[model samples]
Target: MQKTKLKALTKILGQTALIALITFVMSEITLRIYNKINPSFVFYDSSYNRFRGKPNAPDYDFKLNSQGFKDVEFTVEKPAETYRILGIGDSFTYGVVPYQYNYLTVLEEKLNKSGQKTEVINMGIPGMGPRDYLSILVNEGLKLNPDRVVLSFYIGNDFLDNYMTANLRTEEKSYMIALIKSMIKIQSNYKGKVLNPTTVQYNDNLPTFTDEKYLEDTINKSNMFVRNPADGMFKGFVDDAVKDLIKIKQICDSQNIPLTIVIIPDEVQVNSQLQKQVKQAFDPNNQNLLDFEISNRLLTEQLQQANIDYLDLLPDFKATAQKTPLYKPNDTHWNIAGNRLAAELITQHLTAKNQP
Candidate 1:
């Protein structure tokens, strides 16, 4: 009886192992097959009607690196010391729209048309925030030794993205995980095919909260997961950003190169209804994400303390949105007309600064 029972147990174990092996093989085959098929075209959903037909690039060219970033390729031709500007930021700095519609390209065209010998290199990448921008500036932007650096700070999601990804790349294990995450995102093209549409509703008649006390109270009430960088969890984020801006200033000062920051205003800040909706999501009492505001405000103060030149494009960007469909109703990025306006504004600033 004992011998028979032992044999039966061995048979059951063998069967379980066989099933597991078969499952693993099937899953691997399915994944490989899914990878082989070219996915459908991905489109950016617009939140509003005005951004309809705004130009955008249909494909991604650069692959994500192990660092969770794409190796941005730039040409080595040096402009004849008249003006060579390297524009750095997230997707906005990146020509999100088609090549011609990219604001950097527009800025280049407009500047050239104005008979100013200027070379503007677009060093923008998507899904990046201030920390990533600063990292790229330290790691990549410094190589070219540009005459001037134009950094765009997208006010909507940058602060959060910066905070979230900061720690992921700081430690060795976490850095590897982030690299894998970026590689996984390369599969977004495949995943986006079956994506469902999502809509955000805003009551346009909502009133704006203009008081700081209300803002702080609202933020404290709404934000249950506030990880204060001062408390150490977000130290990587705080260090990367604060230090990077300092480095940017130090490098520019040492080389006599100029640095200009373009504060890209969030669409919600312009549309009162959008602001209220966002406030409701973030901090109903504060209305604005004071953390984001504090970070940018501190960055500006740091720039001032370091004597680095800067430009606030919020007013101009807001005005352009009011005039044209600069951003899609659902999307926070600039449309073609908005890109043109941004390019015009950036070029104008650069031109004004370079005036002898």
Candidate 2:
């Protein structure tokens, strides 16, 4: 009787194991098919030391080219009479909007309409910083033989991103974790959240210009240099970023490519109401609200000292904000109007430079 019962138990355990194996295989197959159909995937790039979008990903209306850039396809060899401009930076340059709506694309359209043969390649990668930009330029940007390079330096959290690059670790996700996260994302969408559920929801009752708690939180989230924890490490990050910029300039100079740095300011910097709120929140006594501009001034000064050409967009953005909203209502990134203005400004600057 004991031997018979032991045999039955063994049979039960074998059935369980087989079922699990079959389930895992089915899940793996389904995931691969889903990924192929909806390629919203980002994978770790060992060479660049960061995560990059998958090549040829059909993510929404935007499609990444074979080179993992969020732009149309192009060969390594430049076409005759076609001037290529490589736009490099973080998400602002990469853009979250449709491909044709991005600033680089708009700039290209305006340039071509003005009778100049131009192709602006969007080399922007989301969540990258100065170090990643340098790595990308060395490893990929130069290989395309661009005639000019524009670095869109977004002053929002670049210093913080640069500082954090020192501690960046390789992304590792287990199959089980991925499955769970995917399910959670689906459930979040079902509950009316957007496709990407990483957005922050602010309190409804908070005043725009006077709520201390909300303003403080916004400052901490929006301006990395002004955050309390960044006090001791701010200068170090700025120095590191400056060194990387110099390296980028050196690379561009060697290839005889004109490198232009375009300074993109944060929404708070241009929004008067937000600025007032931040000052009240952080400096009730009106002590030092200008501390956030320190990083911008430092970078500008460094560019001047290095004799590098840079266009500060703060004044223009501020001026434009008086008449229109350049940024999204709640998000940090620029809206369609903002991209249009940026493209217009960049076109004017470049057109002037190319004049006889």
All models: lDDT?
0.56, 0.74
| Runs with alpha carbons beyond 4 Å of true place in candidate 1 | 1-74, 79-82, 169-240, 281-296
Residue 294 miss distance in model 2 (angstroms): 2.5
Q: lDDT tens string, model 1, 1-356?
A: 99999999999999999999887667645544443342111211111111112123222433322322223234555646556777887767754444566787788778878776767777666666665666677776777768888888765555466455544334322323333555565563222222111232222222223344334433443232233534644334445565666676777777877778787766554555444654676646753343334444645676677676777766666565565656643445666777788888877777787631
Clashing pairs in 1: 47-329, 47-330, 48-329, 214-285, 215-286, 218-285
TM-score, every prediction? 0.62, 0.74
Most lDDT-accurate candidate:
2
The TM-score of candidate 1 is 0.62
Top TM-score prediction, candidate number: 2
lDDT of 2 by residue, 1-356 (tens): 99999999999999999999898778767755665554433322223423456678654556688877788998889999898999999989877556776899999999998886888988888888888889888888899999999999888877677655455443223343465665665564333222222243422222233244445556685444364443556667667788988999999999999999999998888898887777776668854644556667878988999989898888899988988988755556777788889999998888889820
- RMSD after CA superposition, every candidate: 10.0, 6.8
lDDT of 1 at 332: 54
